[model samples]
Target: MNASRHLLPVLVLLLVTQWAAAQINDTLPAVVEPQVDNNRVKFTSQLRPLRGVAGAPAPFYTYFWEFGDGTYSFEKEPVHLYKDTGDYPVRLWATNNYDDGKKPPTRLKKIKVEKKTMLAANTPPAFFKGGGSLEMITNQMPRPGEDMVLLLGYRNKPGSHTATVSGSVMLLYNEKQFGQNSFDLAEARSYHQEKKIGLDSLLAYAPAEEWNMPLQGTLTGEADSRGGGLFTASGGGNLPIAGKPQLKAFLKEQMEGYRQHHIWRINEVKQGEEQFMFLSLNTLPEMIKDTNAVVTISGLFIPDDPSMDVERFALDLQIVASHDPNRIMLKNRRLNYRFTGKNRENIYKVQFQNTGKGPAKRVAITVTIPGMLNTGTVELVDMKPACTWCDSAYANQSCIDTILTKDSIQFIFKNIYLPGTQQEGISDPDSTMGYVRYKLRFTKKMKKMPFTSRASIVFDKNEPIYTNRSVGRFKKGLSPGIIIGYNTIPGKKPQDILPQNYVLGFTLSEYAAYKKYFQWEIYLEKSRSYESYDGRRIGGDTMINGVGYKVEYRDQYRQQKVLSLEAVPVHFRYNINSYMAAGAGALVGVDVERSVTPVVETWIQRPNGQGLALMKGAYEKQLESFANWRGAFFADFQLGIVRAGPAAGIRFLQYINPSHQRIFLYASWKL
Candidate 1:
């Protein structure tokens, strides 16, 4: 057992050693090489080589190199151009296949290259005291297949009155003609000139033909003439006539062209006489396409007399590229088709020169959409501000204005000038300038419907009249009773019935027992009278009588019940709110019905044989019942909490019947 244990340990140790060896064999040895320096080759157009030596030569090799600029190379010798004249590190490596049993290799090195420097150009171009010039300066010539940009500054001399200067620049390519350009610049301030192009004269000049190039030349006229002698010439402000005939002819031709083409006036003569006119055929030189060229300008002053020598005038010139290759040139630029739809979906396109010196900034377009019947959408293809004003307006619309919608579309160009440069930034001073395009759609619905009736009725009854009649005297009257009335016709007569007139059948009523106490009774009433009036009053006497059975139930500190059969004159009673009431009716039955009265023996009496007299007396007393009927107008004052929905109110009724008036309290719920 002891031997086995020892042998086991020995065997394990051998196994571990073998495994380690296998791992080592699996990984190829790494070869570290020196780093190469890139600076040595930067200034020269040559390839730099880096080398690494392994322990011995091996087959199956590959190479890798890391340039400083995040780039890798696989060549043993790598050639690279330094974007700028500077120093940089270069690295390289060579690897052999693992089967070769040799470590991969790497190497690095530093090198230096020298660059040549060039002189600087800072001198400004030559120009007359009154003229200006512009030029560009750069550190070095552009490299092969590279682009360079330079800014040129220009300024005019103070106190210079020169106006209408023309100039051009010649661009030479490899010392060969590349392009020629020209530009016309107007003076910053007005100057006095005599016998010059006046507004009226210029207005008469016809516009040049569309195909005809614009005149590209300068104009020079004598400044104001100095006052001469003690008495200066009175008409000194006007130009003196010199070479009048030639000027006149030139003016006539210009005027004709202006009238034909409607060219606007450039200026008007204010003072001095015509000194000289430099004119050029606006067409480009034919040689421009063949060779590079320089531009030179000259002027001559014409004397009034042909005998006088023509005076020479100083002039300036500028050269510019007539054509630029970077420009995307297009001819007769125009919009082809446009379509606008709801939700501001709009598309539009135009043909234009893209590569040339377009307007200094992008063109701005606004699509104004008129509100349409169904669609409510507006779109601007590409919108940008081309000029200062255009920029302001565009900014205003984007930031300050609330009327613009988010879905609107806009199209814009970075640098371009449109045909109406002069007119731009003039009108709508607050608006932006530039080429603008717009497409808009508007939609919505609007409608309205509107409509407006009166009703009144007047009841001609004794309501108010009767109520007013019974003001007081309640105790002397019969107990307040419920009065009912019916209509009855006594007779039909032509004179008595102008219109439909009917008599009241009778007024039914009930009176309770206790005097000046709470009592309840029932009664019936009728009226016998008929009258009709047409413009005049017609009246006739009538009788109201009726037989009624009544039960009296009274309670006021005492209880009482009364049953009676009586022939009583039914009285018509008018009861208003509270204040007053009045009634009129006749007694009819023969026997005066009675009810048993409690307490001591009650006495019953018969008529006093004053037949009509008794009737009259009863009528008088019962008339007091009419007092109950007295068109009692009770002005009941109500006092209670007012609220929405149903509410109960207590009112004090102060009423006056025909015989008397009293104040009673009542409560009611308002629905």
Candidate 2:
């Protein structure tokens, strides 16, 4: 028995060696990323493919359209003009081919058209954002291998600069996640919808359904495991499989789905004299096999740095040395597989454990899918039957992403917290281990056959990656789970609530002075701007209606200066938009000069429109003798804080005369 067991590993090794030799890979096909016009509205329109995928062939593409304005265009990008202003719903369906009554991918959105007369105005300080220099510490160019850490350094630029840097790093189609975990991998490997899925399809997983939209993007870099994938356990690191032969056989089978790449948005940067951002890159394990692939990084500022005149910053790096992937080990925590519910209701459950020395931060498990043993397996719900249920006691739904393809789907589980860190690794029950359970559709059609499957795993701690694959046959069955990545139905979706948003600001307004009104007067101003979640933009009060205010100096004829205080009871501002606002309010004040102002005014324009002399002593005596008051009903027109307003009402004893209305029109600056 011992001899037979030992020989099995050797036998498995030989078979894998033979298989790798028989496999073939010559040339990789191109990718297609279609770009159609996505605007609210346009007078003239244009459509084309991005990069160099254009000019392929018209017959290969099929276009469908719904202009919403009772019109349609079958062209790539259709140009249409609307006779009136209204929201128009637009839809476009683009397909490389229309095969077997299949629906193509499409884009849908509403276009807005506006027709209104607008006046141009020069304004400033409505909104603000600033500048800083960003330095990245990564490969000027990088080669495919282990996941890498990127260091971002930022500093404010000279002279009146903003201290933050916000942007994104775009990696195009270069990112490929494992796809179709439940579909028959073994069948997919051998069967083709049309021309056979070449051996290249193994390393390069583009099922027949994806031929219309090939993976055509420039590949800059990828992640890969180094060294043999070690299985870390309480007893110390050991081979995950029973023997080396099994290990070899697993690696060979994994050769089919070897790929790596994970790049997403860069986070926002806070203002400071200097700041650093650390980024962890997720890549494919297959990339390590290639010793000569370079990786690149690209970054562009948010809202765009209109001043730079440059589009983005790019850096690339190359790989140097590699290590054994087996350094950190991850395996089925439990050593078995089982199934329940026959026909379209079979559930498969598998658990993996880490029996190695290192802790893996990211773990990707690719479950092999076998071709339908029974044609009775007709209806396919949510492509990856394995991912139908993403949450269970063993698996956390928050950390999974699944990508589905015609034949296979891959479940990407990330941020795995194992027992180990830079210093030590985890121990018993810490679960250097985890499990996955899923349900796939299958039924015994004619001949009963043993259920079978093959799977591969890729994991790492940013360096010296680890990977392994295993094949299992069902003398039994198993349980299930869901995804951490990919845009497929039955996949995990984002479940987060947005925070409340609103702007709070302060504004001060100083209107007009009194020398010109032949009396002593006061002047001041106010205004501010911001928006709220309710779609309302509230701002500081705007001086509209132009009943302007004026600057009045102490008149030469009157001497004594008055002491007084002002209280404003009502004030309100209206936001027309981001640029304009109108304001109205009522004001009242107590000024020693208020009571004397009408007397001075009466003395100056004596009902005859001629100057009338008044003594300074008489003004002072009367100012102190009676109760003083001032009030106004004002209207203002404002462009920014520069305001123009007109206010009219009574002053001093002038309130005693019902029709005594003196209007002041003025413009002034405010803080």
lDDT by candidate, in order shown? 0.25, 0.33
Best by lDDT: 2
Task: Give the per-residue lDDT digits (tens) of candidate 2, residues 411-435.
Answer: 6665555433121522122134454
Tens-place lDDT per residue, model 1, 1-671, is 99998999899999999777655643533233332233223211122221223331112333344444323333334444433354434444333321223222223344443452342321221212222222222111122211121111122223324433221111111211123332222111111122334334532342222211113232222111000000001101223224434444534443331111111122222122111111111223332331111222222222222322222222211121221111111111111111212343222222121111122233322222222312224333332232232355554232211134343333334333332212333211112122222333324321011000000111111111000000101121232322222222234344644221221122123221111122122332222223222132222222335432221221112112222221333334333212233333333221122222222211122234322211111111111121112222322232332111111222122223333333322232211
Instruction: Evaluate residue 347 in candidate 1 and report its C-alpha lDDT on the 0 to 100 scale.
Output: 24
Q: How many backbone clashes does candidate 2 have?
A: 105
Residue 535 displacement in candidate 1 (angstroms): 25
lDDT of 2 at 151: 41
Clashes of each: 114, 105
